[model samples]
Target chain A: TKISQPWKTTITTDESVTPWEDATQYNNFYEFGFGKSDPAKYADRLKTEPWSIEISGEVSKPGTLHLEDLVAPNQLEERIYRFRCVEAWSMVVPWLGFSLADLLKRFEPTADARFVQFETLFDPKQFPAQKSSSFPWPYMEGLRIDEAMNPLAFMAVGMYGKVLPNQNGAPIRLVVPWKYGFKSIKSIVKIRLVKEMPKTTWNMLQASEYGFYANVNPEVDHPRWSQKTERRLPSSLFTPNRIPTLKFNGYEEQVAYLYKDMDLRKFY
Target chain B: MLKSRWVKALLHIALLLPLLEECWQIWLLVNGMPNRLGPDPGKVILEDLATVAIWLLLLGLAITPAKQIFRINDLMRFRRMVGLYAFTYALLHLLSYLAFILGWDFSALWEDIIKRPYIIVGTLSLVILAALAATSYKAAMRFLGKRWKKLHQLVYPAVLLAILHEWWQAKEAFNEPLLHLVIASALLGYRLVLFFNKAFSGIKNQQSLRQTARKNS
Candidate 1:
């Protein structure tokens, strides 16, 4: 559970990091439950020690890798990225992880691997909310092949210079800085590289609201609410700390090239 | 039974608890005290007050039917306070949105109203409640005279609008909003049934009277 000799990365933000307490307590890990604090309250029941991620589909090295072996070789680095939720709130976190590209390279994805699909652990006994039929359990998400290999894409194992919290996607989680927070799936237990586009949880639940890309765009409004502005966390009542949302959540310079000529409005 | 000063006082205290609790929670929220109000306390405050307002509205609406069904005329004595309290909670809910959510940003609110139609629905409900609350007193009621009954009848639409507001805003998880819809339907449905019964019985009585008059002539 330790990130030994972690080094700071250059691709990071100077914005104020959301407090560790706030970052861990406030979560959208719906597997434990949907309430903001539900994950923090119930996530402790999850046994992360004996974790093994099954890597399969269009990968030469498709095998069950233990948590230690999966993360051992890569040199952990800190990344202070802006995380924006689809719900119009945001936070800055110092995430500790290695580049996802590095991990994907080790897996040796074949030519047919066009999309990478990730799935969370599906133990109903650990995550009580998984029993609810509202969501197809074992929360799933996918990234385009080119997008997956983006320099900003990270496989986070810890945040705020500590081990990743169970509530905040323990063991390991995908951190797609340019996309909406939900696009960055958590508590990953399965990794499958597929050809056709993979079905994501939110997109499956409501496609009109959540798209596969899920890039943070102020112009394309969510059907239910406006995504034009976001409330930065730890904002007081007097000072709402509202800021205009940015295209690709302020990572446009780094990741905008991935969506070159595609109609964002339609894709959104 | 409601005539007892002690009972009235107790009822008032019971009704005021949610307001006090909300005030306390907002205080903690503003001060950054560790609270269960979660990350977006402003949103929590806004949503909490709205729910409280709706609960009070439903309770106030139930008073007439509750009195008739239970034969407890004393319930009528508390209707005014309950209605006023409902209005108060709704007023706070609006303020919470402005102060906490919008930070008094009128432009943002205007944009939200334009983009999100549910805000308009909620605002309409608030306006109706405001009118009802203003005329809830004896002086205003007496001044309005016959028009008072007509003005008060707007409460039905006000409650319906509030329910619609909740339903419209509820995007995916609709269990709570669905419950509110059901409760409002049942309460309003009872009133509609009573209204029709009176109208139909009156028609039958008038027809019988006309037949009697013709025979006499």
Candidate 2:
């Protein structure tokens, strides 16, 4: 199960790394519950083992693949990426995974595959929040074919050099560094390639608040709150260590070209 | 119950418990202890204080009805303390939000109050609570006389506004706010029934007095 580390240089940042305990404990995994600490408290019920992802739509090899066989071929890498939540709190996570492109390529996506959609485990028995009508139960997220194929788009199976804790998306999850943390669907049970842009859970719930391409843009704000600044997690008591949110979460140099001529405000 | 100093002291402690608990948690958080406030401790504290403030407001409003129904005159003595505590919590909630969420940025706070509907409603409720707290003393009560009662009537609308503020701020889980709304509605509904009953009895008494005068003539 020990795959060779493909990446040597850890993604460095000016900000201090968030404590692993804080990062794992404070999360917005609504499948557990609405509260921030709900995931850490209730995610233990999740059965991460004996999991498989169904690959369908626009793929040459459309079939079910066990979690182990799916990740066996690719080498895992340690990526210390900035994780910006839509709620204006941020964390730097040291994730271990292979590039999502590598996994998608193995399935032999057809030319018609313009989008790659991901879906989280939908069983109400494991996820208690599924019973609540707050949001659509099975969390779904999507990325353009080129975006999914990007080097920064990762399929994280572990974090802090250990197998992902149930709260932190155990088994396998997508980690798109440039977008908000919610786009990185956790406990993924399905990945479908399609010609049209897929409807994401948040966007479907409230299109005005959440958009399809949830790129971390400072100019564009969430309908409820401003996203211009972010409070770094584990901030001090008196002063919140707030920093200006970067465009595309500081990956503008790499991913800005993807939306060259398109208006980010409209797509946001 | 009001004659007993020990009973009064116990009621005071019980009323202050929520604020004291929040302060203790904040103290732990400030000292780098793993506190219950969670990651965004300031935000959590702000919300907790606001929620407790509204609960205290409702409890204060419930005192009169409870006293009337149960025939407990001593309940009125605790109503002022509860109302003052509600005001204190509301002040703390606003200060916490301004200091923590807005980072002491007055312009941003002002903008929020002006632009955000929830903030506007919350601020209005706080303003009304402040006025009620200010006029709560005997000296102010004497100076205002008849106007004091009318001014204090604003508490009803303030409670309604506070409930609406909480409801508007709710993003996903509305059960908590909805429960508060139901409780507020029931309290107000009880008051309405009492007012109409009093009005009906007053009319009947007037008619009886007229009939007594005719018999005397």
Candidate 3:
């Protein structure tokens, strides 16, 4: 496999990258089960070898792209990003993937394509949690057309310089750096360019709590808990490495222009 | 069970097991051993300790009903110990949350209690548990007399509030919280049934006594 140049200059974070074991084991992937450790325990049943993404809706080139062909043309890069969860925890991760803009551009999106929607693979036989109706299965996430085109918007295939583990959305996944981690839908099976804002899973579940944009804004707190501060993971027992959450998750310089004139609090 | 000192000692150890387990995990974490406390060890420990407190509260609530239904007089001896342990764990749970989650920031903690309904509910439940614990001693029990029992009835509401706190805090999966709700409901339901049964039986006895007096007249 040909690897792209590392993104040392293009992207970086002052925070230390979370340990591989901690990042992989402690996750909130509801596809496996509700427990944080459930994904790592049960995700092995997922079949990633024969993976393909169906590119459809408002796109000139609408067809299924196999995993191999999807990555063959693009140069992979390690983008170290701070992943902030809506639950007020965070991890600095070194993700290996290409720019989402680079991938979406290949499909030739139409002028009517105002939004980009991504879908995760749904297999009850593989994902046991799919049996439960906690969420409308086949997790979906969306981004505005311009947001999708942002340089920070990534489509990750691997991390730690190795192919993604099954639990961490193997084969391929989306990584929107400025948004909450859940917006980066995992194990993507479909990409749709649509005219209207797509209904994302979390937003559909609770619109008041989870907005369509799902941007990392500390001021817009979740209905259940405060988002002003986040406990960075791998913290010590007594004192958690708590830090004040930044607006746009510290990516305001690049992504703020995209949301100009729009009320983030209202949209969020 | 209280008849034997050995049984009493064993019961105390059994009640302390949850706290002991938490200490063991902390030891393992400090010693750099592979422990069950995951990435956010503080959050994990705080949640586990809170759960332990709730479980003990539920067990303590079950003792009176179990004695009534099964004629297990022995169960009474363990009720006080279980109640005290629940209070101890609840206090520890609060401390853990303060130390780990809030980082001992009193201002933030106050804000959480005021702003967040779940935290408010949890705090109220802890307050009720504290009252019950303070009165659990023999001197307070004697001073309060019948009032002690009445004050301790607050446990029913406290447990319900604690369950609500658990339910409200849940983000996605509600199975565990729902299960806790079901258990708490069943315990309270049993008490209600006993109360109604005694009232109905008392009325029936009064009616029979009136009939006997009329026949004698």
Candidate 4:
């Protein structure tokens, strides 16, 4: 079924959109596998239907909410956001979703809810990579309450003016535009309102490299590779589309206030 | 024994195919046409070159062990050709990074080799390959004499460094890198076993010669 009213909004990049093929095909969904194309190839295994997300912890309303009913209250808006991967590749994608703040407010979180932790579907049968004990299963990510409530922080249900493909986090996913793409956890199955900071997947894997606040900062390089520049997707061999990466992925003016007092480098 | 010359010719044609395919992809990119290389052809090409370089390096390492096991002396001649091709691919891989990835930005290239452990490891492996390729000719072998053999032994470390480079680059995904490491271990392990066998049971050359001299007497 098609998404309801994915009308275009001003919250979009002026840059050219990454081709749907590239955006969908070239993915790092480790649940399916590690290869760039693995997710696209093996995503059929995921069962997005009969899907429900458990909203629990410090929220006033705690229950397993079916995906349809959860998405029913709000109007879906089209947002073309710039997605910058931690590996120094980037894409401009037109995502369809309602504001995350809109979704979180419905849950009626208590004052105790300082952090919001999200989890992906943990079914090893669907996610074959979960069979490997290399990474702690059930990919988890968290954002501070303020960060979660930020207007720019979106919960994408679809992209490219249609329902999100199973490989591209079908049904639901978070889209924190300012952070590196990994923080925008895919195929979310749980949203827990907790008091303490949550242990994130990549950060848990390598604390020295991926931090909790993976804000796209050009100055702050990943220990392994430079973040100063990114190869924009749909780029060919001779005509390179490598461009200088912008701070906060060019959304610095909008979201920089969220980390006003905190040093991004230290947090990153 | 299979003719090493014929094998070398076939190997050249086989290796040339991938490079030719890349060239076709490059042509497609230049002409602004759709290509199979994917969105970032430059990155894809860079990876392809690196993959070929490492595979060739591993194949070069496997030659001696394979020859020993199969008792095919003809296999020895192909090692130099394999080593040279491996160096060529490695050189092209680094060049691709400089040209496509960096856009000829020497500063970033310098910084990457100096600071980034993966790139540094990769560069070190390539440098060792370069040294081996430079000294592979007969004149260099004659000039260096016994030292040449000692220097060529650097192939073990060179291959290990390349594997380490691959491991460093492929951070979380250890499957492919681990497989490469296991293969390297097996190839290098065979040589170690032979060395230790000769050490413990006495050198085969002297022992065989003594038996032959006694038989003659």
Candidate 5:
């Protein structure tokens, strides 16, 4: 994986004061354990030292890159955005990183780069949950070439001010705030640039519901469920059942251009 | 060779029908295509339904210990049915997640289970439930012998995983998870006490036999 050069900035948030912790520590990754507290509990065992990402497919240069090399060259920036999950929950976080568009441009996606596929590191010995067929582990995620290069998408190295906690896709992860939470693939190890749209794990498992473009728009109803409202984690039961989802997660000015002339209702 | 009228009646209505009903409901949730159940209700209801199934299964798992600790032996009969109900509901839960949550996108499902901690944990609990359900039959028990007990022990971890799955998603309050945690703990604790009690009795019996032999000599 080829990461671009330095674009430094003054650290906006406190790196020492625990950066910006997620308003809620509990995460959707329940394989390690099931409590809202489970990831925080068991994530400590995840070894971030000596992490490496296996880069493959369609790229002229295909190889693995160490985590140190990936973050070493890049400068961090704080971009606060709203993260809306498909489960109808939402959160606001100040994520630290640079644009994914900048990073992908360095790799020089070829004319054949129609879509970019990402694979999470799947080692059952390390991540025991991978062994269970209940889910095909080393979970995969993908983006159309244009989506991958969207300016809002961040190839994040840190969140808050400091390095990412292991529970929150430590080392590096993709943060597509406007899209559904699942679009933000974490703890990535492989990047495969491909001609055809790669089968994202969830999309392949059930194509009708999870489309290739899992944009977080209120208008698009997942055939069996609604995307109109979100729960906002840490909210009380009386805190209203539905909060109208925004288009482009409130970043329409920047990203709406990418979808011009395209039917969002059909494409979404 | 002999069949009791009550047992036969129970084997059909009490046991068989609920199983059938549970499967039918899951089929409705999973196999039925769009518009069969009206418009998509949205994510909250799906989450609610999944949590309900998880709790119901935990309740079913608790029946055996509940009966033993409370000395309500009759409750034992309901354990299998309740557990099956949990799996039945879990199957629906899994389907909803695949259909509604992931939009039946296997790729997205794969990415989530790998990349997201909550999805990974929730899926783990479902897998455990699947394993338990697959082996619930008498034929499996007869085939495995002593290993059957060990395999069934997975129910404990599975229940714990289920609680965690529900807790993480609940997000709103700790009250529900805490309550379910307490119930599951008590049920598990009863098993520990039973094990020690049985072990202690066996040791006392051995000692008494040794003393009797020495006196006779």
Candidate 6:
């Protein structure tokens, strides 16, 4: 258990935020417990100091990077984007991040590297959600090599302008706005570049529920429910049911070309 | 026979009206008809219907327990009503999802059934709930008495499906579904514990009684 020592901000945020204390305070971090407020209630007691990420696999640099060292070089930029969960609910959040493209370039992924996999921080001692056999803990999500290299793919450090709250993946996380929320793995502690398609935690747990790409495409519906529509969250009980989900969550101009020749239905 | 005829007629009429109302509501939604219900028409309808269905099934399950625990035998009369409402709202959940969300397109709906896991669970829940609703009447119950209890066991699966459906669908925060699962688990757990306790005690009493009778003989 590494205790966090106060480190100077080598990388400054392009901006500052009021910080959503409540966002992390009120919700259940099911990754920790089943109670809705349990994660928030208990997460406050969590030790957030001295986090480190194990960078391995096909990467040229395979070593543990401290939280401070990992974030020291990157310049923070705020990208407010719409986050849509596969569950059909949605939320618009302003995330503070830098491009994953920049990070990958630093590691210099080999030409054979076909996929980038992120592993969430998964110590059973801290994250109780790992104990439950319902779904695997330290949730993992992956991206194709191109997808990971895409400028749109982000390695987020903060949300709503302030440093990330523990419940919302405090240290660092991925933000693929064009994909469903789960594709954005949180509290990442490991980054692996691999030659073959990496087995994502959710995909491995239930391949049918999550896919490798996991892109947000309304045209490609979820096997069980129509992804054509979504419920924007914080909605009142009487609010109308759904709004038509947009293609690539309306980011088609940036990402549509990547899947130009591939059939989304099959990939989905 | 005439009195029974009247009862049957009343049952048909009673079930028909709610079914029609649900259909009418769906039609209003599908045709882009005006609904002064809420800010987000589709979500408003879904949440409202979900709440109604959750409570309805809960009420349905409450009948037998209430009758046994509180001696509230009159609760039996509301069982059909609760089941019907559950069916009606679940239907609305499916329809509003199809017509409004999927724009009544078959291709999109088909893909959804094939592609999404949460949706698969949600759809299966609805199907099971629909089956339970389809056989709610006294005639069907009389025809499938023991089978009715067996069929209604599908309720357990349906409730779990509903919770998963809700949980998997949540966006950023998982407070609502997590809370719901905990409550549902507790309720279901209590019943399971009580069943074993009663079953074990019944066996013990029967064995002791048999022993006494054998000695007397």
| Top of the candidates by lDDT | 1
TM-score of each: 0.93, 0.90, 0.94, 0.92, 0.55, 0.61
Order by TM-score, highest first = 3, 1, 4, 2, 6, 5
Quality of candidate 3 docking, DockQ: 0.71
Candidate 4 overall lDDT versus native: 0.89
Query: Which lDDT tens digits does candidate 6 get at residues B1-217?
Result: 3235565567557655644665576577556564433223455455656766666666666667777788766656666776877878788877777654555667766766666677888888999988988888889999997989899888988988988888776543466677667767766776898999999999999999999999999
- Better by TM-score, candidate 6 or 4: 4
Task: List the candidate 1 regions with Cα displacement exceeding 4 Å.
Answer: B29-32, B199-217
Candidate 6 regions with alpha-carbon error over 4 angstroms: A1-29, A34-38, B1-217
Candidates' lDDT values, in order? Answer: 0.90, 0.87, 0.89, 0.89, 0.68, 0.72
Better of 3 and 6 by TM-score: 3
Q: Alpha carbon lDDT of residue A7, candidate 2?
A: 48
DockQ values per model:
0.56, 0.45, 0.71, 0.54, 0.03, 0.13
The segments of candidate 3 whose C-alpha lies over 4 angstroms from its true place after superposition are A1-9, B1-3, B201-217
Off by over 4 Å in 4: B28-34, B197-217
Question: How much of the true A–B contact set does each candidate keep?
Answer: 0.46, 0.30, 0.70, 0.61, 0.00, 0.20
**Residue B114 shift from truth in candidate 6, angstroms:** 13
lDDT of 1 by residue, A1-268 (tens): 5667657675666788898888988898888887788999998899899899999999998999998999998888888999999989999998998999999899999999999999999989999998988888878999999999998899999988889999999989999988999998888999999999999988998898889999999999988789999999967766788999999999889888889999999998
How does candidate 5 fare on TM-score?
0.55
Which lDDT tens digits does candidate 1 get at residues B78-108? 9999999999999999998999899999999
Model 1 residue B61 CA deviation (Å) reads: 1.9
Candidate 2 per-residue lDDT, tens place, B69-112, comes to: 99998888888889999999999998998788778877766656
Better of 2 and 5 by DockQ: 2
Candidate 1: Cα lDDT at A171? 84
